[model samples]
Target: MAKISIPTRTLNDGYQMPWLGLGTWPLQGRQLTDSILAAIELGYRLIDTASRYGNEDAVGAAIRESGLPREDFFVTTKLAGRDQGKPYVREGFSASLERLGLDYVDLYLIHWPLPLLGRYVESYVEMVALQQEGLIRSVGVSNFLDDHIAAIVAATGVQPAVDQIQVSPTHAQVDVVEAVSRGGTVVQAWRPLERNGGILEHPTVTGIADRLGVAPSQVVLRWLIERDITTTPHSSNPDRQRLNADIFEFSLEPADVAAITALDVGAPVKQDPKTWEEF
Candidate 1:
């Protein structure tokens, strides 16, 4: 049998997203275009961008230039926290669509919980309505805790299709993962590699990389794959981009999974919204 690559998971809302995608956060200028085009050429069909990323136009330009039809790619963008009102959600999605030059996106997400903003649930209501209008194919949330998801579902009687959180070996987020999984929502891991602070060079990951004869980055990505969470890892180098996609060739052992799981140090890499950040 042929080797199967790029596994996909079915969302509760009846859509499919590839197991791995190309993240476009913090990637800007000519580098954004070059990386996106390189990723597309490297067989990565899922491109995860957001209004906050400030690269939607670059992403759109590359997509148009790639000669790939809208159906051939899975494009995901998010509504910025500042745009979390009923009318603003509507305008935000429209602006994102305009920037991407698409009528509908594969997935639309609320970029942050923004509970302090005091209108996240109301914004989600608009997102649900937009789905009905055929303007949004799927609606979801990002950085949403269980309480946040429950509030939205209770108010609207519709659950978000996906909940994206920052997940990695270091920041496991097991509680959030369990809650979202129990709610039948797909979980997407942003910053899945946990860049900064020598994550890729960590002893646990580098050891696996040496054993597998692959780069440490590949080992880290595969670690996410084995966990079954959808990951969008951002890389600009051509070889690194291609190597990131090559994770499916080898499988990490169950023991290796357990070891990687133990690497979580009981703290998040970035600002933790639950305790530190106001959002």
Candidate 2:
């Protein structure tokens, strides 16, 4: 295995966030605990989890048992769909903290816009309050569209430190990324492998990997890094996890980057933020 030097992105809020992280979704029980421990052992400092994942307790347990200082890790948890109002923002964060067995998280995010509920602005206001009180180091949102982000900033006069969204070659989310960038908010790509879209096998990506003598996944991840977008690709296999984090060793040429960019079809495999209402 190659030696990996993880890079950090300085947020507008004056805090540093790791560019690569371990995403814990659809993981539970021993699988969750073991993967987290393995990731930490492999030098993964950022662990992304959420209340909806139903694994915060397991995540907390693994962190406590790791014998690592809390400050060494960047822990991020989200407020669930059910917890999307001004009234529940603090309550939701408190529950997440208690479950994670932590005094404070490095980042807290609204899981979704929940636009129908029409309270995300209010919820974000409370997140700002929590940040002021030292409960969270940064505040952000997941699956938020450009309009949603603009609304939050317009209302509170504070831009989010990050915007976690589903992005890949197939779903570039160019508009959203540019919009978030205008506010100096870093865009974090989830499902960066495009879930089951077979992005790794796409000729454009694999061709680049072949020329560069790296795995197809490495090629894709490197492209995102070159674009200055943070990505967290989830995998339970320890080897795969290490491979995902080992992207620092190679660089994709400008032509290869352009080829991958041309692969974007402007569609998302998951729920659209405009209509997604999962609780």
Candidate 3:
């Protein structure tokens, strides 16, 4: 893959975040460390992990071994559903920092809404306190809807810096994207390639990929970037990692973007934020 210039988006808190990142989920031990190291070597500056992912320790090890200055990377981790609540929020952040072997994380997020528990707001408030204490640089949420974000801001008067949610060509999430953008909050897409189960094989994606002479995954990721949304696609393969980041070399025309936008199926792949209470 050809080297491409990575882009960055300014968070509401004035922090610059790489528009593309390496997602580490369901990866642990040597595989996790190796993949992270490879991603860094492939020019991935942002690393996304979660307490539930159980790989922060490995992520920390890889970063430390990379010999790169701490400031050279953007690390993001999340508060698990099981760790929701004001007290646990602090404990979770501390634990994540310790596991990552870092003094502060670039961005900290509530992994889910868990609205039934009625503690997400409480947890976010505590995250705000951690941000003030310099333990967390910027605070945000994941798998959150527009109202969830609105409620947090309405209560604490502090808008989240980013809202990481599921977005792709099939699951466009237009409303959520617009909502976050309206608030000056950056939208980060998780599971960006798994939309509707087999996005890469979808006719729209494959057609565009064939036309662009790039992998289907690259087309999907580039489409997301073209929409100004941040994304972190996980891949243990070095070639795929490089392919995911090489999207900057070409531009997707407006017609292609519109055609992909027309592929929205109007449903999420899994785990609707409104009802999901998984811990």
Q: Which numbered prediction scores highest in lDDT against the true structure? A: 3
Q: Model 2, which residues run further than 4 Å from truth?
A: 1-3, 268-270
Error of 2 at 252 (Å): 1.1
lDDT of 3 at 45: 87
Tens-place lDDT per residue, model 3, 1-279, is: 444467888888999999999999889988999998988888898999999999999999999999999998999999999889977888888899999999999999999999999999999999999999998999999988888998999989988999999888878888779977688788999988883368889888899899889999999999998899999999999998898998887879999898888899887657888889778
- Candidate rank order under lDDT: 3, 2, 1
**1 or 3, which is superior by lDDT?**
3
**lDDT per residue (tens digit) for residues 89-202 in model 1:** 888889999988888998999888877666889999999999999888778988888988999999998888888889888888777688876778788888877764588888
Superposed Cα deviation of residue 182, candidate 1 (Å): 1.3
lDDT of each: 0.83, 0.87, 0.89
Q: Itemize residue pairs with steric clashes in candidate 3.
A: none
How close to the true structure is residue 122 of candidate 3, measured as C-alpha lDDT? 91
The local distance difference test score of model 2 is 0.87
Extract clashing residue pairs from model 2: none
Task: Record all residue pairs in model 1 with backbone atoms less than 3 Å apart, i.e. clashing.
Answer: none
RMSD of 1: 2.5
